[model samples]
Target chain A: MLKKVLIANRGEIALRINRACRELGIATVAIFSEPDRPSMWVKQADQAFCVGPGPVARSYLNIPNIISTALITGADAVHPGYGFLAENARFAEICADHGLTFIGPQPRVIAAMGDKATAKRVMKEAGVPITPGTDILENAEAAAAAAKKLGYPVLLKATAGGGGKGMREVRAPEALEAAFVTAQAEAEANFKDGRMYMEKLIERPRHIEVQILGDSFGNVVHLGERDCSVQKPSHQKLIEESPAPALSDRIRKSLHTMAVRACQAVGYVNAGTLEFLVSGNDVYFMEMNTRIQVEHPVTEMVYGIDLIKEQIRIASGESLGYAQNDLKPAGHAIECRINAENAENNFAPAAGTLTGVVFPGGPGIRVDTYVSTGTAIPPFYDSMLAKIVAFAATRDAAIARMERALRETSIEGVNTTVGVCLEILADKRFRAGSYAIDFLPQLMRAGVS
Target chain B: MRALASLEGLEGRVRALAAAFVQSGLVRLRLSRGADDAIEFRRRASSAAPRVPEAAVFSANGAPERLYDVIHADLVGIARFSRPAPAAGLALESDRELASVEALGIRTPVRSLGPGRIVSVLFDDGAPVEYGQPLFEIDRE
Candidate 1:
């Protein structure tokens, strides 16, 4: 077992990792920016250090400082919870060089999956279904040519992008050039790589993803799938649920099988997720997240597994202790991300001191948050204030439970998405489990929420 | 006993006047209350050095004449000094290298931004230090 770990991220995810480590009898050191000095996670950890100023680049993303801190604090491993340098291959390599376990996949594996186009190709070579797309286009004309061949509606995506950062949807031929230029610029600004690829857009597909865990000893198991079709207009996921309601069993099984196959093919280790776009019975691989996701709690609730613990164990060279057949997922789970944003005002980010906070609690209901009364939500980082998850024996029960939980919760001194989540829970299509990825955006456009 | 009695309630006024002296470019200030309690404040030659941030002022020579600035480490690593660790009361020149923090064999120098006298050393030689960890407390000249 690992002895000590340095949590290299802030907010609830950092606290989440700390909880897992403490449960396993491991000491944790938390790193934070200046503005996050009073964070609950910092106080909960065995030790905490201020790495830099308020800006993420100077603090949370400061690889040099983070590595030095781990070494100085005598931490045997580093757990990069979710964002910042979690998926950075070079940071992983540095950790290895300093004789500290990275608590994730090999650096080369991260490098392979970090590039979107490369990941698609890898999955395709492993016999996984992938959307037809072009490699890095040479120029605007090349993009236009690829779009024409692919079809009318095509997605121009950055080779190095995720979370819809450098993505543009082009419907017609005339709009291709401008879309390509803008996407290229965005990709350059975000990822510092201007490479562009095109894909045939799968309209209104159900965004289902399978969670998998792999040990270094070639043992990989699937934790089933999550339906993340509910998203804002910016493509940020707001709600996720397990078993992917309404998905055919055959397709679901295929996704799970393909996810394990892809992991085995790439020699992937640690916790990872394979996202797919499901239209009808057909599924196409979108990309693979090389780190633990924000919505991992949904999977954890259904599987009864602590994924962060598994990640640490795998990094420590331990066997998985259980095989594929040993896993039995139970009940249903749903998660709603409560961000500090105004849902009615185009989901604009809100920052202020939280003067009041009340989170719901009961059997099968879990609230993960780093905010409490007197917590100042800074504008420098992600706006998410809490994650409310509800688990029940069925999907409908889980939804009802989640609605009740949201109603019981109240956060003051900043605008939040609690009201919007209540509206989504009551939407008829959401209740039917037939909502598409564009459902929330269309609802907002209709001024329903 | 006479001096203590005369300085009663004058401590607050002395602090305000000293803060104004350090912030302004004025070279000197003299004030006299009656004929007996005459107070003279003089700026040192290097007092023109940029004002140190986060300096704690303490009274010396019966007036608030000394300011202690805590020099903090800018990197997380093992702190090293080229020579012996400067002892308390050792004067420091502006821009002089006080120490360096070495991480992964790369050294980042920690220098004195202005002239000052060492009030104390917070860390021992070759001690591990984190970012913003105090290393030395310097009395600004």
Candidate 2:
């Protein structure tokens, strides 16, 4: 077992990992930027280090500073609490080269799965269903030809993208060329890889993903599924639930099997998620997130597992404590990302000093936050202020509980998405779990109308 | 009155308190040692005679017109204000209220912008203020 672990990230996720490590009697070292010197994670850790300045590139993404912190603090392993260098294969390789265990998938697996095209090909070879699409196109003419072949309403995706960036939906052939050029430009700008691919856009599909955990010993199992359909273009996941309500038992079982198969096929270990776009009974693989996802809390609440702790254990060369047969989702859980964005102002970033903060608590409400009264929300990071997750025996109860928690949440200094999240939870279509990826956009448009 | 004269030496101390009040958005500075001797006076208009209020006598004494107080509201910092008296070298001193200090309204409740932790309390007593000013600094978690 590792003596100490260095959390190479910040915010709620770092706090989440720190909590797990504490329970497991593992010491933690936190690395933070200058702005985050007084952050909750820094205070919660056994030891803390000032990595660099505030910009992510200089701080959280500063791989050398992170490694040095780990080494100096005597941390035998590094746990990247999602984002930043979590999926960067180079970071993982460097950790291993320096004799520090990276508490995630192997660097080779990250490299293969981090590339969308390669991951798709690998999934297809493993008998996973993928959307009908073409490989990366060379230019606009080739993209137009591919769009014509795949029929209209195709999605232009970046080969090296995630978080909904460098992606566009072209409704017809006329829009294909322009969308292709724009998508390429965006992909190049964001990921530094201009490579673009095309996929048939599945209309009115539910975004469901399976949480899979594996060990190096080849033991792999699916924890269950989470419904992440309530998303805006800002990539804020307003709401999420477990055991996706729309899916029948047969589809659920198949999804679970597919998730396990995909993990095994890729030799995946540690914690990861396999995302799918489900339309009716047909489910198509979207992509695999090679690290812990933002919505992992809902899965944890429903499945009664400490995923971060499991990642630590797995990285310590321990086999999964339970088998596939032992897995069972206990209850319905929902998570709402409370972001510091003004909904009335097109979800623009809201930054300022928070004067007062009151979080709601009851039987089923779980608030994961890193803020307090008088905290200054810097503009350099993500806009998510907190995550309010609710759990109950049934979906309706969970929804109701989430609604109450949202209403009780109070933040005075900046505008937040609490109102938008409340509206989405109360939405008739969302309540029925009969919405799609375009649900929020349609709601926003309707509001404009 | 002699304590008030010594309080004039509290100029640098008052300015530091003022800056802290502005930065904290809410700060409370108590009249710690000289409460009995230090008279907390608000300036009032002199009736018909065009006479300055007794509070403005300090400014008229050429004892630096920059006297200020760090106001607190129920242990929360509110605002900072220079002793509001008639302007210096004014021909006619109007009988107007020099300044006003009131408790913060409960209905106009303050709130936080994000989930952050309170790092420090700048004020033990509530802050006093003029009209427009900050209250406190919340450290983001």
Candidate 3:
């Protein structure tokens, strides 16, 4: 097993990784920006180093400093928790060059899966179900032709896009050309790549993703699927639950089998997530995240597995001793992302020193966070405050437990989405477990009752 | 009574005296037990301990009292001074090389930012330094 790990990011995910390392008896070295000096993760770490200033480019993204910190501190592995350099293939290569194991997939896998168009093509070639889509379009004429074949309301997506950037849904023929130009320009400005693809937009689909883990010895297993349909208007997930409520057993089993098959096709190792858009009986491949995702807790709670520790063991060349049939995931788990943003005012990020912080506890609840009273929320990073998850015997019980957990939570001195999440829990559509990606946005638009 | 000439052999005592003088915040110190037993220590305008908040202080007549420049490490590595570390009171040019931090076989040089007299060297040679760690304090008054 790896002896030491350097956590290469900040906030809640950093703390999550630290907890895993501690439980595994591995020493941890935390790299933080100057503004995050007082963060709980840094204090909990065996050793901490300030990498740069407040800006992400100079701090968390500074490859030289991050690598140097790892080297100087005698760390044998690096865990890029969720964001920053988590999916950066070059950073993984640098870690390997420096003789430190990067706790993720190989650089080649990351690069291949990071591109949306390439991922779809690879999945299609592997016999995974994919939506009808065209490869990277060359010109506006090509896009128009592809859209005509795919039908109206086709979506224009950037090959290298995320967070709803450089994505547009064109509902009619006249909107295609302008939408393509705008999307191309936006893609260039955002990702420095103007390549675009066309897909038949799946309307009001449930965003379900299967969590899979593969070992270097070719062993792979799927934990389960998470329904992440509840999302903000910007396509950010707000709530995620395991076992995807209301999904047919056939579809769920197919998703799991396909996820493992896809990993085998790419020889992928480490933990990965394959996202799919489920519309009625048709399930279409969306994309694959090459690193451990933010919603991994939901899968972990239900499957009773420690994914971060598994990533370390796999990266250390340990073989997975268990087979697919040995695993039996039980119970239902739900997670609510509590972000420090004004949900009523377009989710404007709020930054200030947190006070009166009270996270819920007791039966069937897990709070993963790095905040406490007097923790200063800097404006340089994402506004996520905590991830409150609850596990129960059934989906309905899980939802009720999550509601109680959210109510018991209170964070002072900054705007939080606690109220919005409570309202979502109370909504009838959400209680029925039939909501889609548009559910939260429509709820917000109608002024959350 | 100890002669100033005899004090030359007591290097440790002289260092202790300097420390005491800096701690006392006195501009100068002179101790004499006899005509031949005399020793003196003098501090520049800004050489006292707890460096006056790091900002430029002004005199009553409007002239700058003292301006200091603190140099910090830009990367993390083991600091290696190519030569002897700049001692207190050593005058240096802006571009003079003080040390280099070596990591993964790459050496990143740490240089003096401006011409100034060395007020203090915070870290020792071969110390493991992290990014933004203070390395040197220069008095540019």
- How well is each residue in A1-449 modelled by candidate 2, as lDDT tens digits? 77899999888999988999999999998887756777899999998876665678877897766776676566899999888999999999999988999999999999998877789889999889999998778999999988889998899989887777789999988888888888889999899999988889888888899999999999999999998988786645677889788779998988889989989998899999999999987899988988999889999998899899899999999999789889777989999898888877778888888877999998999999889888878767888879999999999999999988888889999998888888888889988888888899788877832
| Tens digit per residue, CA lDDT, model 2, B1-141 | 997877776765565644453344232223323323231222222121111122211232334333222211211112222233222222212222222223222212333333443333233223332112223333332
List DockQ, one per candidate, in order.
Answer: 0.29, 0.02, 0.27
Candidate 1, chain A: TM-score? Answer: 0.95
lDDT of 3 by residue, B10-108 (tens): 666756766666446576567655444445655455432212123322232334345567777878889887576678899886668888999777998
User: In model 2, where do residues sit more than 4 Å from their true spots?
Assistant: A138-141, A157-168, A173-196, B1-141
Instruction: Give me the displacement of residue A69 in model 1, in angstroms.
Output: 1.2
Q: After superposition, how far is residue A177 of candidate 2 from its true place, in Å?
A: 5.0
lDDT of 3 at B6: 58
Interface RMSD of each: 5.3, 21.8, 5.3
Q: Which portions of model 3 show Cα errors greater than 4 Å?
A: A136-142, A160-166, A174-195, B1-67, B93-95
Better of 2 and 3 by DockQ: 3
